[model samples]
Target: MSVALDGVGFVHANGHRALTGISLSAGAGERLAVIGPSGAGKTTLMRVLGAALHPVEGRVAVLDVDPWKLSPSALRKLRARIATVHQAPPIAPRLRVVTAVLSGRLGEWTLPRAIASLLHPSDIAGAHEALTRVSLQDRLFDRCDRLSGGQLQRVGVARAMYQRPALLLADEPVSALDPTLADATLRELVAQSEATGATFIASLHAVDLALHWFPRIVGMREGRVVFDRPRDEVTQEMLTALYANEHTAQGAADSAVPMHLAVCRA
Candidate 1:
């Protein structure tokens, strides 16, 4: 298995319980999507899976090893095999695109080489090649601050690609992109995952896109796994119920598929 979690739970610093009793497992070379409403703990769940946040309860085993049990060096080495693309990539604004993409290797590079990369990007061609997958090769040298939101999102994806990780995790990776670009980018990610036989998982709010792209669908709500089943088994009724409280919390339960979701699904 690429990932295994048993009775995982997490709490925020502010005393909010973000996840509870979340058990999930994914096999190598499998592609899955996590779909949930806002504040449903999707992001928190991804953080736990990525080893960025240790679960306060239960166990987490990625690539068949427990991350929290590993030594510091071993943990870093294990993390190098896993890559994450954040919802809002925490990249420096002033850094050039190529530099940001090359940062993916910081986990694997040596001390001297890592520092040297900050001074001068060590592999311009490699960065460019990764960016090419997202059609951002033309902006390889541009400052990150100069790019639009959608472009920055793509840059994050490119960096993940450059990492060549065994386990890939993405949090709303195409949220800022237009419909066409979002579809194209997701197709690209799936293609690469298939080529490399990497375990790919993404958290998305777009129900249609998640259903169309992934074979396995995991639905989350109130920090719990409401359903874990094959994509074809996910019904419209299930989606409606999953997002029920999200809309009802505001006021009405608008039965229509959300406009924000359609923006990417189209």
Candidate 2:
């Protein structure tokens, strides 16, 4: 297995419970999409899977090892093999695109090489190659501040692709893109992950996107998983109910199609 979580729970420092009893697993090279409304613990779930947040209780094994159990150095090594493409790519506006992309390997590169690359990127060709996948090759040397929101989002994806990680995780990776870019970007990311034999998981807000690209679908609600089903088995009714709030039972689920349509638009 590439990723597994058992009875996991996380509570914030401010006494807010983020995740509860999240038991999910994905095999090597498998693709899964997690769908839910806001505050469903999807981002927290991604952080936990990427070993950014330690669960207050239960176990997490990523790439066949528990990261929390590993030493600091060992954890860094493990994290190098896992890459997360964030909802908002945390990149400095003044940084060049090449620097941002090359930073993906800083954890693995030697200190001198890393510093030199930061000063003057050592692998412009490789950075260009990755940026080309997202149609950002022309912006390879441009500073990030000049790019639009969607452009920055693609740059983040290029960085992840450049990392060549064994396990790929994304949290709303294409939220800023228009429909066309969103579709194409997801296709490239999914295709690249499959080509590299990397396990891919994404927490998505768009239900149609999830259904179209992923084989397995997981539905989370209020910090818990409401359903986990194969793509072919996930019905419209289930999706409607999953997105339904307390005020929606009598109103939304009665006509599942509209509820689903709204979710897809979202």
What would the TM-score be for candidate 1 when compared with the true structure? 0.92
Q: How many residue pairs clash in each candidate?
A: 0, 0
User: What's the residue-level lDDT of 244 in candidate 2?
Assistant: 72
Model 2 ranges with Cα > 4 A deviation: 246-266
Model 2 sits at a Cα RMSD from the real structure of 3.7
Q: Write the per-residue lDDT of candidate 1 for residues 133-189, one digit (tens) a residue.
A: 999999999999999999999999999999989999999999999878988898988
Tell me the tens digit of each residue's lDDT in model 2 across 76-106: 9999998899989999999999999999888
Model 1 has an lDDT value of: 0.88
Give the C-alpha lDDT of model 2. Answer: 0.88
lDDT of each: 0.88, 0.88
